[model samples]
Target: MSGQLYLGLDLGGTKIAAGVVSGSGKLFSLVRVATPAHGVRSDLRALFDAAQATLAAARIGWPKVKAVGVGVPGAVDPRTETVWAPNLPGWKSVPLRRLLERALGRPVFIEADRNVQAMAEAWLGAGKGASDLIFLTVGTGIGAGIISSGRVVSGSRRVGGAAGWIAVTDRWQPAFARLGSLEAQAAGPTMVRAARLALRTQKRGVLARLARADRKLTGETLVRAARQGDARARRILAEAGEHLGRGVASMVALLNPELVIIGGGLAEAGDWLLAPLRRAAKKWGQPLASRQVRIMRTRLGADIGVLGAARCAMLEMEREKKSNVDFPSNQAG
Candidate 1:
């Protein structure tokens, strides 16, 4: 509290997590709350509540927080400070930065969640030593953050890092057209749907039994079942892994990243996902780039997103200090 303290908020689809982090990448207090499904209003309330709770838990005050950084699951226009989050209904063109500035009484920085995750990894996590890397999150949805020559790549529209739409297959399906080709085939929900479809034809596996018992299937359920020697579950994961690998291969060929760090919920499957992903990447990826790239799971675990947000805050604070610009407090939205 005496020195510079940064507030990091990860506004995920299902949960909003906030953490107070020091300038040296030390996390102080972390808090999480379920994301309200109602709309953007509820989501904003949940985010504010989580941030306030985290600050209180850390024994800090609003004035002490040098800057606040938020990572949202969607496109963010840093220039206009607007957000277009598909998962958050009614979030199209929302002025997230201005609203957070008013609510938190501090300057706020917003970026795509995956980009922040890549920043966190490059700064203090698995991709620490790598100057060029990609952080891919394969969970409820699929996305990628690209870093080249030690810089985050924000394309012309500031949406270049969104790799979920990367085409992994030539065949065009409705889901692919709507949700992005790679995400349509490899995201967590897609995996579950694939498993359900597979069970219809081949009903001989622990997956079928588990689906019958639970009455619903999830990526976690499929991963757990796969670990228990469920053939269908393993097959589904393998297929997803292959699709994911193809996507990674495309990224590598284009970006030539030194490392690729995979995170998010589905990553809990560990080697079950990595092994096949590695195989497919090597098979489909540009040989030179794929051979040079090192693919690994995230070392930061659940804290990656928040930590990434913290990194963004720290960077923003540094920029402000260098430019000698006083960050406005309680700005009007």
Candidate 2:
């Protein structure tokens, strides 16, 4: 945290977060705005407004910021500076970097949200010391940020860690149309749906009672019921865990990462979800890869996205400096 400060933006389906972070990975301040449901116009306005508010709250001027980084919840191609975000309607290669740069008057780098989250983890979270690690974030959709040999494996198409797209089964259901097989089976919405379906066969339980009453059956509901020792709720989570475990096994076999850090809404299920996931990974993963990999839930909680975005900006500044680009001088304030 001894180096210059940078600005980072984390854009999500529900909110947009902006923060000031140090080169050494300390977040100084943060501001958030609810994402507008109208359209891209509203979203862009909120994005810019959040940035301005973040700097104001930090008591820092734009000139004091070295650069900017954005984390989008989708695929990002740095070569083309385009994004393919499923959550953002009518958005594809929208030139997000240019938009932010024009508004903020600084170099803006846009990255995949998973990559950004992984960056934050590698910097100061669960992955701090692991040279090879996977940040598997499971929420609206499943995705991964893979760090190999201390560098992000963005792949040739900048989609190296699209973990949700992994096929956990041979059967393709209609639910897999939008999200991947693994995600369709294990993500939040999918888990909720599974819990509701379980109510058909298991007639009496906390989850069953909720579904019978036509009340909202959300991820939180499932976790609460499972914690209360509801068999049906625990079974739903275990089923989802089976699919997630298979997904983990595949990643372990292919990437051979030292650590797999799970984060997001579903990871809060604790051992109810993790136990089966670990068992499957050990059972199905390549023997050598399975033996050494350790899986754990993220401790950073809600702050991961904001911190990741800031860390991404800080890292981009370092990258530009290494490439002999004209790095901005961060003068003392």
Instruction: Residues 1-333, candidate 2: write the lDDT tens digits.
Output: 335888889888667888898876677888878878467778889999999999999888898888888888888775687888876677777888887788889988778888888888887798888889888987767899888877788877787788888999999798777777888888887887777677667778677666556577778778888998898789888888888899999998988999999987778889999999999989989999999999999988767887887777766666676875532111000
Model 1, which residues run further than 4 Å from truth?
198-216, 324-333
For each of the candidates, the C-alpha root-mean-square deviation to the true structure, in angstroms, is 4.2, 4.4
Candidate 2: which pairs clash?
Answer: 1-24
lDDT per residue (tens digit) for residues 107-220 in model 1: 899988888898898888888877788899987778888888777877766787777898887898988766799888888888888888888898877887788788888787
* C-alpha lDDT values of all predictions: 0.85, 0.81
Model 2 score (lDDT): 0.81
Q: Which stretch of 10 consecutive residues in model 1 shows the poorest summed lDDT?
A: 324-333
Q: What TM-score fits each model?
A: 0.91, 0.87
